[model samples]
Structure formats: C-alpha cells, structure tokens
Target: MQLSLPFTTLLAGVLLALNVNAVPVAQQPRMVTLPLKRMEVRSDEHPRILLQQQINRASKRLALMTGREAPTEAMMTEALRKRVLEVEGPEGLERRRVGLFGATKDKRFNRTGVPKNGKRSPKKGKNAGNAGNAGATGNTGATGNGGAAAGSSAIGGPDSATGVEVANTPTTGNSLGLNIEGPDVGYLATIQMGTPPQNYLILMDSGSADLWVASEACQSTAGGDCGNHQTLGSTSSSSFVASNTPFQVTYGTGAVQGAIIQDDITVAGLTLKAHTFGVTTSETPDFADDSVPFDGLMGLAQSTLSEQQTPTPVESLASAGLISDAITSYKISRAADNLNDGEITFGALDTTKFDQSTLTTVPNVNTQGFWEAALDAITVDGQDTGLQGRTAILDTGTTLIVAPVDDATAVHQLITGSQADGQGGFTVPCDFNQSVALTVGGTVFAIEPQDIALQPPNQDGSCTSGISGGSFGTSNTEWLVGDVFLKNAYYSTDVGKNTVSLAKLV
Candidate 1:
C-alpha cells in the first residue's frame, strides 16, 4: 500500500528541498526500511487497545463520509468490518492483502504485535492505510511524496525506541543523536509569551505532546494573565514573527492562543530550523503574569496530536522529510540552579557517546512519537515499591509523572515521609543520601542525588523550590512518567527493537 502524506508535510518537503537545493533528490528526504519481526497470530486474545482506538477513529471518518452523525463504538466496529468487506469484496480480505502503513501479515510490533485479525490484518486488512489519507484511493498509512515514511524512518529510527518495539527507519544525512546531550528535565516554560516577561529562559520540552507559551489570550475564568513568553516586538529577541496561525493550546491545566509565526526560536545554542512558532495576539492575561519572556511555543508532540492541539514541530520535521528520522531517542537531566539549554539531535542515539548497555526499544504511536516504555515497577533504591508495572509512557512533552493518583500519592509519601516540608512538593533532608531507582525492561535505574531531591520543601532557595505532586494529572488510569524519571537514563525508542531500552546514565 502507498502512504499519502498530509499536504502541509508535502509542502514543507517541497520547500525544504527547494531551499536547500544543493542535495540530491534521492538523498533529500531519504528513507530506510528496517526488517520487522513476524509474530504468531492468535484469535482468542482481544485486538490491541490501540487498534481498537483506530477502528473507532475510522468509524468517525466513515460517518462523516456518508453525511451522518458518528455511530456508537459497537456500530463503528461493525461499520469498519463492513467497510473492509466493501473494499475486499465477498472473498474477504486475504492474508496477502497489504496494509497501507507498511504493516504486513509477517510484520510484528512491540506492544501491537499480531493483530486481532492475525495474519490477515495486512492481507486486505483495514490498516493497510487510510483510503482517504493515501490520496483519494485511500492508501492509508503508506508514506507518499516519493517515499516519505511513516513516523521516524526518514530519521535514524522509529521513535518507538522510546515506546514499544516498532520498525524504525531513517532518512539520509540526519545523524541519529547517537550521542545527543542529556537535558535537564525540571525547567519550566514560562507561559508569558509577550509584554512583561522579556528574556526569560523557558524549558524546551520534547516530552509533553502539546506546544504552548503563556499568553494574554487565555480564557481562564480566574482572570486573563500572560506568563513568560517574549512579547512580540520585544527587543530581547533578535527576531520574532506572528505567522497568523492564531495558536490556542489546551493543556490538562491551561490554554494559550496566539498567531503562529516563523521566528528565531533558540535554546541553549540549538537553533531550530525556521518554522512556525506561536505567539499570543489575543488571550487571557495569566500567561503574561508568569513573568517569563518569549513570543510563543514550539510543539514537540507526534504528528497525530496536531489536530485540536499544539502542532508538534518535531513530528512535522519528520513528516516533511526534513530531518532524517524522527529523533531516535532523547536524554534529559534535572539540573542545579538554572535549566541549561539541552540538545535535540535528529536521527539515531549516539550509543558510542554514552557509557551504557544494550539499547532496548519500543514502537511509537504517531499521535506523538515519544520515548515510551513499559514499567515493570518503580524501585526506590534497592527496594521494589511493588507498584504494578504497567506500560510507562515516557513523555518529554509532559512535566510531571502522572501515575494513578493513588499510586502517585503512595510514591510521594514514600519519598517525602514525615520530613519537615512546607509546600514546594516532595522533599528529603538537605543531605539525603539514598538513591531512588526505577526498573524497566528488566533493568534497574537509580535516580541521581539531584534528581531525587525533586524539590526542597520550602519557599526558600533555588534548591528548595521543588517538584510538586503530579505535574499534571488527567482523568485516566494510565500513568504518565515524565522527564523526572527520564533524566537519569539514556533512553532509545527503537521501533525496530519492539522494546524500550533503558541504560544507566554515566
């Protein structure tokens, strides 16, 4: 099946190819295909949860296509079943049928291995690609645009190395951050994008799926306030623009609105390619009140969350075939004092640079291709916390570790105990000596001393301003382990590995 890329992605590809015309076409937007494992098929087990979500999404598309309201989940499932039949005919979708997204009967996945449809998934399966997305014919997930790939293959590997085991491929010329720098995870992005906050350093997040900058256009009922984004036309920034894409980002906690623009968005020495950044034109004043500087935000979510959310710049680069592959993996650190400018490398993780072990990996769901892993348990020091190890979503996009509230409370209590703490969040003695360890992929990872000090429990010094309860909790059971846990580890989301690899930081 052929993949149909979004028009925006195609346009970006064309612009990039044209702007940097020095390279060869074959080399431009390069692509690589990695071998995938073929897993055994089963009938009794239920279809993977993600597949079910897709089925539901497809049903909505079907309803829209036919000019009708959306159907119930059951009805949607039935509709998809019927639609597959309509496309495949009375003989039924055969095992030989290829899915639009490079998914084949023989291809296996990390978490989503062996379809409920089994070997027949790709064989006339509905997943081959979306009939509408793959041009009008609906190639589904097939990469269009003369060989654009799904997710990060155009980069060094599947960002899935961050999540589940997936077939990660890479495009050419892009270096797989094989040795990317580890960034501090604790820094916060001052929401104030304009006006008061002028040159505040904000956290360049690659984890949480949405991109937002505090702006005056917020709809917070409490009041309108802008936090720390540089006000447009601010002198601190050498250059800034309002792209007119009026950006409004809705987070689990707040929202921001402004225009998208092409500006010089820089952090630490890494200057992002000239791209669409957000700025507040009309908004609530909460962002301005934050006292940070900047114009807007840069989205790092996967390409999937662009709709109804901040556009993921990272995924856009991948889809447009700009940077090689989606970033294979990322390293983060929580630092002392100021949050330093971290690094963001395209392609592979520089394994040679890190003093670590084998790279376990996982597949990344496109909505936001993040470094994801399954958590077997959270071990504090040498002890097993007995927390049920469910799949842990390692998101640079999010700020806090959102486990089941109860789980979070338990972990928080264990770390804080009856220490003399005020309100800055979790705190231990100034000279806490024990190491907090988290185990994944059968590996035990110990959190560094600084990382463990999450935050001092007081309104006191820099070291004291600490990590609060949950960074941001959602109304779900799935635990979102944010950068706090990721800082001490060298993580790679190798789609090819079908597993999330964890390595101890040197």
Candidate 2:
C-alpha cells in the first residue's frame, strides 16, 4: 500500500539526505540495551479491555498511515461501548467492569500521588504552582520524577519499584533500561530531552514512526491535562526551538496535538542533536491519566512512516554514525514470568538473548512502513487451519494479537470450548492447553499455553484468547502481531537491510 505523505514536499530533500547518510560504515558496531520493568497489574484493568484498546490502536495506526480519516478516541470508545452493550448485553458489560477506555470511574480520577519530603501532597494539577518550572519535580511514582536534581546527570537514580538503577553519567556502549507497563502494554524508556536535559518516560513503539512528548505549556495553560508526567518546551528548556508548523497524531486509544519543535534527545547513552519532534499542548485522557506510566511515545518505524516528516531516532543515530547499524531488537518479557528481565537493544542484535541456530530473516513486505512479513500458516494443536497468504505486522506497542475476522474464527474454531464473544473476540476455557504455532518464513514458532490463554478468567470461567479479529489494510489477511506472540521469541528489525529476523529465545 502506498502511504499518502502529508508533508511529502517539505520532507523530500530531508528524506533523501537521510537515506544517503544511512549508508556510511562505522569503525565498530555498538549495542545499547534498555532493561524493561513489568507493571503491577490492577484488578480493575481487565484483559478484555486491554485487548479492545489494542485493536483500536492497530486500526487507527493503519488509518493514519494510509491517510484515511481516523476515528477520534471518543468515537472509538463509544463505538466499543455500544458494541459491548449490543452484543454482550448490559450484564456482560457490567461483569467486565468496562468503562471509558476500560478505566473505571474511580480509576480515572485516581491520580498518582506526589510525595514531598516523605509526605503525600493533596490532589493537584501536574506540577501545580510550579508550572513551566524545570526544577520542579513531577510525578515520581513507578517511574522517577521528570525534573533533574541538582548536580545530577540526565539519568535518574534507581527506581525502587523496579530495582533498576539508571547510571548518573552517560556511558559509552551501554544500554538504557526500559519499564514494561502492565501485561506487555508497552515498553517505557527514560530519555533526556532539552538543553538542561529533563527525564521523560517515553513509550518505544516499532509500529509507528514519530516522537512526541507532553509540553509544560499544556500543564500551565490549562490547555489539557498532561497528568503528572514530565513535560518539556521553551518554558523548561532554554534551547528549545519551535516551528510554526502544527503537529497532531491520533492513536487507537488517545491523541495529541502541538507544534513541531527541535531539541536534543539522549537515548541509551547516545545523543541525537537538534532532533525534530512534537511537543504536545493538548492530549486525550488516554495519555493524561496519572496511572499511565509513560510520559510520551517514541516511534521506531522507518522515516517514511513518520508523520513529523523527520528521520527517526534510530535513523538519526545511524546517519550520525553514533551506531554501526540502524537495527533494533526486543526480548520482551511476560508478566506471568515475573522476571522483569526484558530488554530492547539498539544498533546490533544481542546474540545472547536468542538461539542463533534457529535465527531466520524475512523481508519486510509492507510498503506503508510497518515491520511486517508474510505469515505462511497457522497451526492449532498441530493441525493446519488451511489459512494462507497472510502478513503479520510485528508491533511492540500493541498488547495482543489482532487477526483478520475469518482467520481468527478459523483458529478459535479449532480450539476446544472456544466461543465467540460476539464482539470480534473469542473466549476459551481457562485451562486451554492446545498447542498453537505460527509459521513465518517457513519456520514454526510455537506459542506457550500461558501466552495464548490470557490471565484472569471471566465470570463464566473462560479466558480471553490472546488473538482477536480485526480489519486492517486492503486485504483481510493482514494481522497485527503484538507481544502476545513476540514475547515468545527474540524479534529484531534491520532498517538498512529492510528485513525482520525472529529466533527462538534462549
């Protein structure tokens, strides 16, 4: 599919230069690792709700990339709510405890508490009374505060919750750590931005290409609630350069709009100078919730997919020769594992994380700028489902697998005691142990039963399958393959080679 570029004319020359600069060879290949922290699951946040959100995000991502008019978060949520009510009845809705964006009434208002000198402060706006003040510490829960302490480097101290300590000084050839929120909701990396360098927890996404963070202007002007997350702009950064160009991006669950700006961004011990990205002045509640751990999002897809029409961080690193290659790899961890051992490596693949003997590489076939490859087949309990010609978009931002409607039904029909939830999803017995595997590049990657049958059974003693039905792309065979399947393997993408490699996890 051809991507309808929004700012093709403006970015044409920049894109050409980036492509040329991406080819220079480096003396030594460098690898930076980002450790991941698993989020504490809440009883109120249902797995089904997360599944719906993932579905919405996948759809909107495709819509935005294809230049289609994407539905607003309100429209998407209302549609889901209406669908649940119509198909499952009011009792089912109540049983699932479904609310706007899957957040309960009280959960929406339950903001993260900011402690001052070991005492909890009253509920107030993000950095209240200290808006636009770089020195003021913002939400310091799960992730550390946004403000950099005096005499402190860009990296913050150890996070008590995750037990991971970020180095105070930038280390050469070292990897920054990442926090995994919820059951693989997304990966969070603490990045320093601006002149003085304030820390911001950013969601690293491979499915989309665009970097953006909430701005202090949003919090100070009452333009929108940025929650207690960190923010940066001219108010907080002396070197921040703003453009008159407007920036807006819509995700499946949320949306943000602001102005294009240029600033310095440091990630994984490497700095990308004068990086152009968005500084959000307004954002939806999906991103404005204090319970949400990430302060912003960093899209790792190719520069062509970038809405900002700027080279991605990885691309910039490659162009600047900060890294030997424009490659990113993920060793995602599951909440069930409780290991907190997940990590994302940039520049080069970590051979220690995967079985090199079983490594297989496939060309990325999606022209619309997604890390996608052909899915040859799917087998349930060692039986072929006869499905064919399907492609899977490996997305880290998504939590579950979203398959085409017919393919989802075909796979679920093979599982014993599987029933359609009437909402484009299927519920299987909680104790489902059927062997499921996906065939890609003629290699079979088996999925664990725990990964297939999600946690927390429904009131009817049924658990939601990690796979659901959804529509994306022109053909119905496209699948949004997320952490549900990715966690079981070592997934990596080589931007320069335009190939995706998957290997058995060691």
Which candidate's TM-score is highest? 2
Full-model lDDT for every candidate: 0.35, 0.63
Tens digits of lDDT, candidate 1, 3-98: 111110000000000000011123323331111101111212112221222223322322222224433434533433343444345444343234
- lDDT string, candidate 2, 57-132, tens digits: 5555545544556545565555456555654678756754543344443232121111111222233333322312
Query: Deviation in angstroms for 394 in model 1?
Result: 2.6
Candidate 1 RMSD computed on C-alpha atoms after optimal superposition onto the true structure: 22.7
- RMSD (Å) of each candidate, 1 decimal: 22.7, 8.7
Q: What is candidate 1's local distance difference test score?
A: 0.35
Q: After superposition, how far is residue 96 of candidate 1 from its true place, in Å?
A: 68
TM-score of each: 0.47, 0.78
**Distance (Å) between predicted and true CA of 275, model 2?**
1.9
Off by over 4 Å in 2: 1-29, 45-79, 82-173, 219-225, 471-475
